[model samples]
Structures are given as C-alpha cells and as structure tokens.
Target: MSGLNDRILGLGLLVLAVAYGWVAQQWPEPFGGSEGLGPETFPTILSVVLVIGSLYLMVKPDADAQWPWGKTALELLVAVIVLVIYALLLEPLGFVISTTLVVGTLSWRMGASPGKAFLTGLISAVVVFGLFNYGLSLSLPAGLLEIN
Candidate 1:
C-alpha cells in the first residue's frame, strides 16, 4: 500500500515538475536585456530538482512508511489551511504580517509557547523581508506597512 502511494505521489510530482518547468520557460524576458540570472532561473532549477526527486521516489519507495491519522492528520490539514490563507493575505497584509501569522500558528501547533512562537515568527519574517528587500534588491510588497 505504501509503495503504491509513493508511486502515485511520484507520478503527480513528476507531472507538476514538468508543468512548472514549462510555465517558468513562458515567463517574459526582463527589460533592458537578459542578465546571467533571470526570473525563471530559480523555478527552472527547482523543477529540475523535483523531477529528479520524483523519479527516485518512483524507483525506490520506503516500504515502512506510515500515513498520519486522526489528530496528526488534522494538524496537517490545519497547516495547509494556514498556508493557503497566508498566500491569500500576503499582498494585502504585507509579507511580514502574513508570514508571522502562518509561522507563529505552525510553531504553536508544534507545541511551542504562544509568546515564543510569535516572537520567532516576527524575527524570522523581519529578517527574511530585510534580506530580500535590502540585501537582494528584490522588493517584497509592503502593503499596510508601505511608506509614502
């Protein structure tokens, strides 16, 4: 049963990888000519890695694998829901706020104290936001935090 599940998952991921790669290739070329690293570079690289990983999973699945049940499964579902909500709210709430909410909730779900979890999330979100916005010159949306 586990092997069968692995095969199915691998097949699905393989399809997703192909689609991802195709979509990455369809991205418009940046203005002022293409530099060494374009917007599609990371997604293309990720797609390649996913293709390799999915192929390996299809070829050799762990027989001892077990699926989550009851509370564990519910927790996983909650995590997914939180991530979906985070994605939806990111543009409006800003990366810092949305990321903090998602990360804090997930950390608390994993048994961390509420204060510690929220603090960790805030620190992580701010650090990453600074890295991308300042260090990398990639502007993440400031949304509610936007300054005129």
Candidate 2:
C-alpha cells in the first residue's frame, strides 16, 4: 500500500511538472532581457528538477513510507491552498503583499509567532523584490505597489 501510495503521488507530481513546464514555456520573451536567461528560466529549471525527482520517486517507491494523517495532512493541504491563492492574488496584491501573506501564513503554521512571522514575510518580500527588481535586472509585477 505504501509503495502504491508513493507511485500515485509520483505520477501526480510528474503530471504537475509537465503542466508547469509547458506554462513556463508559454511566457512571452522579455524585451531586452538578459541574453541567455529570460523570465521563464527559473520556472523551467524548477519544472525540470520536479520532473527528475518525480521520475525517481516513481521508479523507486519507498516500501515503508507512510502517508501523513490528521493534522499533518491538513497542514500540507493548507500549504497547497496558500500557494494557489498566492498565485491568484499576485497581480492584484503585488509581489510584496502576496509573498508576505503566503510566507507569513506558512511561517505561522510552522510555529512562528504571528507578529514575527509577518515581519519575516515583510522583510523577505522586500529583499526578494529588490533582488529581482534590481540585482537580477528583472521586473516583478508591481501591481498595487506601482509608483507613478
């Protein structure tokens, strides 16, 4: 049963990887972006890694693996929901706000105090926004944070 469970999960992840990779490829090329790496590069790389990992899981299912139950499973489900919501909210809330919500919620779930978790989220969001918007010379959608 455990091996079967692993195989099922691996198959699901494989499908997700393929879909993600395809979506990544659909992104329009950035105008005058870096010569070699474009907006899709990181997601493409992640999907590739997911593909490899999923394939390995499918081929080498752990016989003793036990699926999480009760609280653990619920927590995992919440995390997934948060990520999906984050994607939906990104363009409307802006990267900073959306990332802050996602990170803070996840951190709180992992036992961080609410204030600390949100602070961490804010700091991380700002730093990452700066890194990508400045250091990497890539533009993240500013959305509501856009300054005229």
Candidate 3:
C-alpha cells in the first residue's frame, strides 16, 4: 500500500513537473533577443529536478511508510487548504499580506504563538519583498497597497 501511494504521488508530481517545464518554455524571448538567465531558467531547472526526484520515488519507495490518520491528516488537509487559499488571495491581497497570513497560519500550526507567528511572517515578507523588488529588480504586485 505504501509503495502504491509513493508511485501514485510520484506520477502526479511527474505530470506537474512536465506541465511546469512546458509552461516555462512558453515564455517569450526577452527584448534584444534571448540572453543569459531569462525568466524561464529557474522554473525550468526546478521542474527538471522535480522530474528526477519523482522518478526516483516511483522507482524506489520507502519500505516502512505510514499514512497519517485522524488529527495529523486533518492538519495536513488544513495546511493544503490554507496554501490554496493563499494562492487565490495573493493577487488581490498582494504578496506581503497574503504571505503574512499564510506564514502566520503555518507557523502557528507548527507551535509558535499567534503574535510571534504573525510578526515573523511580517518580517519575512518584508525582507523577501525587498530582496525581490529592490535587489533582484523584479516587481511583485502591489495590489491594495500600491503606492501610486
């Protein structure tokens, strides 16, 4: 049963990796022609790694694996739901707000106090947002907090 579960998960991840790689390849060439490290490079690399890892899982699953039940399973389900909702709200709430909420929820689930979790989320969101926007010269959607 565990082997079957691993194979099924591997197959699903393999499909996702292929689709992600394909989408990465579909990006248009940058102006002044394709050059070093375009937008697709990182995702394409990650998808390739995912493909390899998934294939390995399919080939060699863990011998002693157990599926979660009861509270643990419920917690996993809650995490997934939170992540999905975070994705849905990211564009509307913006990266900082959405990330803060998601991180705070996940951190609290992992045993941190609610206040500390939210503060951590806020700090992390700001740092990463700064890194991407200023250091990397990429813009995340400002959404409701748009300055202009």
Candidate 4:
C-alpha cells in the first residue's frame, strides 16, 4: 500500500512537472531582444528539478515512511484558508494588516502563543513591506492606511 502510494505521488509529480515545463516553454517572450531570463526560466528550471526529484523518490522511496494523511489534510486546509483570507484582505486592509492577520491566525492554528504569533506576524509584515515596497520601490496599495 505504501509503495503504491509512493508510485502514485511520484507519477503525479512527474505529470505536474511536465505540464509546468510545457506551459513555461509555450509562454511568448517579449518582442524586443530577450532580456535577462524570461518569467518562464525559473519555472522551467523548477519543473526539471521536480521531475528529477520525483524520479529519485520513485526509485528509492524510504521504507519507513508513514503517510500522515489526516494531519497533512488538516494543515493543508488551514494553510489554504489563511491564503484565501490574505488574498481577500490584501486590497482592502493593505499589506501590513492583512499579512499580520493571516500570519497570526496561521501561527495560532499551528499552536503558537497569541503574543508570540502577533509579534512574529507584525515583524514579518513589516520586513516584507520594507523589502518590497520601500527597498524595491514597488508600489503596493496602502489601502486604508495613510501612506507615509
């Protein structure tokens, strides 16, 4: 049963990699002589890596492996919920508030203390905002917050 599951997962990963690689290769490059690497370059590389990793796993899967399906499913569900909430709140509440809320919620769900979660989330949001919006000069929506 475990072997069967490993094979299925490996095959699925291979299929996903092939699809991603195909899509990356098919994407049209800008008309002007190609810049550094196109958007597809990273995805193409990642797809190749995924394929290789899946092949390796197929060949020599760990014998002691136990699928924690229930725990994994719960975690995945929580993560999806966190992402959805973050996306929904991004435009309205702004990066800091939305990111903090999502991160804090996720941390709490994952069994962190509320105070620790809030501190970590706030720091993460601020750091990310600083990197993307200030340092990188990308214009993220300020939303309800007054842009300083």
lDDT of 3 by residue, 2-36 (tens): 58888988999999999999999999988789677
Off by over 4 Å in 4: 69-73, 80-104, 115-148
Instruction: Highest lDDT: give the candidate number.
Output: 2
- The clash count of every prediction, one per candidate, is 0, 0, 0, 0
TM-score of 2: 0.85
Ranking by lDDT: 2, 1, 3, 4
Q: Estimate each model's TM-score.
A: 0.89, 0.85, 0.89, 0.61
Higher-scoring candidate on TM-score, 2 or 3: 3
RMSD of each: 1.8, 2.2, 1.8, 4.3
Residue 81 local lDDT, model 2? 97
Compared with the true structure, model 4 gives a TM-score of: 0.61
Worst 10 residues of 3 by lDDT: 135-144
What's the distance in Å from true for residue 102, model 4? 4.6
Instruction: For model 3, name the residue pairs that clash.
Output: none
lDDT of 1 by residue, 1-148 (tens): 6688888899999999999999999999888897776778778999999999999999998888789999999999999999999999999999999888999999999999999999999999999999877765567878799999
Q: lDDT values of the candidates?
A: 0.91, 0.92, 0.91, 0.83
